[model samples]
Target: MARADALEKLRETLINRRRALVRSATGELNQLQGRSAKTGDLLDAVAESLQSELNSQLLEAESRELTAIDDALERLDQGEFGKCEACDRAIPLTRLRAVPYAKECIECHRASVKRRSHPAATINRVFDSYQRAQ
Candidate 1:
């Protein structure tokens, strides 16, 4: 449950998962390509639709997980890996084991979830502000 051990486990897991994901994606891509060439119009359409949805889901999950891993690595480099983002306290080792990519401790994370349940309008406002500054 040491910080370094937690980081090491997360790093290893991310690497293995990424390798598996790449293999899975390649297999799916090859299957789709074959189906595109061999199937008739109706069958091809269905295959294409299913393939598209599968690809979307796979890519989304991969991207999200990779981002989390990368963020964790960045924190590792910063020597802030086991620290909570919200309260600026040390994140519990047990919690880190449960959620290797955790940015905040449990209480802060719950607060964040509550806040995000209500959508914010800051996206457009931030973009507008940036454009006006430009």
Candidate 2:
């Protein structure tokens, strides 16, 4: 398909996803707020607390995705969608379809993930260097 057509399709997908996330988040918020802390016993209270925590985590993830979707929409409007932010390369249609809000191409995204996953290693290397200098 043409580039414009592809982007339009992705835009529709993003909008639909945004709407779904909003609906889900709103429902989760209402449920979280409407739940009562008081329960019949300690076990029930613990279960309620665990459920509330899980809901909070899901809501947080949804909120982050909503922000990313909003950013992707803005990029689409600005004629910058489907381009990797890190490498200035056009992200593949397949990747875009898989992750509508992806900001980087596969290579760049993998590198970013690697970097993120090895922060402790980086820190250890730095410490080793500092120790050698001392």
Candidate 3:
């Protein structure tokens, strides 16, 4: 398919996902709010609290995804969609299809993940290299 056609399809997918996330988040919030603090027993109370915590975490994740989708839509409007934020390269269509809200291409994303996973190790390596050069 043509690039424009591909982007339009991705836009539709992002919008649909955003709507679903919003609906799911709203339902979760309502369910959490409807729950009472009082329970029949300590065990029940603990279970309720755990469930609430899990629901809150899910809502948070959904909120993050919603924000990503909105950002992607904004980029689309600005004619910047499917361009990697890190490398300024055109992200592959397959990657975009799998992750409509992806901000970076696969290589950039993997590097970012590696850095995040071992910041201390990366810093140590950098320091060691600097020391060696001195």
Candidate 4:
């Protein structure tokens, strides 16, 4: 694809996501700041615990997205922006339109998803060990 086309797509994505990002971050900050004024330590612990979990997940997703965008931009600099990372094939324009941060072609992405969905580990330790032992 042309350089102008890639830039236009990138700008559109930035414009669409920027306001939402700002709103999310600002809302979280306001809640965290207002928390102390509105409640005691016990209530604050509950609220902050929930907010911290939520914010952590959101931040992680945002970090992944930013990394992808940076990778795409770097690829553009090297004139390989639309190539699939897994297969070294040219990613389809339609897929690129739908997902500008896609690093793999459709086939490879689907295969990867399939593999991820059936993860081998059943012992994901999200629960405390003592609780589990009980």
Question: Mind giving the per-residue lDDT tens digits that candidate 4 earns over 1-134?
Answer: 77558645764664454445456656766665665555467876897778877776655555455555566667777877778989998888776765665678889987877788622111112112312654
What is the TM-score of candidate 4? 0.63
TM per candidate comes to: 0.66, 0.84, 0.84, 0.63
Instruction: Report the candidate with higher TM-score, 2 versus 4.
Output: 2
Candidate 1 lDDT tens digits, 3-112: 67766776675466456646766776666566645656887688778877787665555555556657777888788887889999888877765556677888887797
Q: Which candidate would rank higher by lDDT, 1 or 4?
A: 1
Candidate 3 residue lDDT tens string, 9-117 = 9999889878877898899998799779465788888888898998997787677667778999999999999999999999999888867888889999889878787
Off by over 4 Å in 2: 118-134
The positional error of residue 51 in candidate 4, measured at the CA in angstroms, is: 1.9
Q: Per-residue lDDT for 50 in model 2?
A: 89
Provide the clashing-pair count of each candidate structure. Answer: 0, 0, 0, 0
Candidate 1 residue spans exceeding 4 A from truth: 1-9, 22-35, 41-44, 117-134
Question: Whole-model Cα lDDT per candidate?
Answer: 0.65, 0.80, 0.80, 0.61
Candidate 3, which ten residues in sequence have the lowest lDDT sum?
118-127
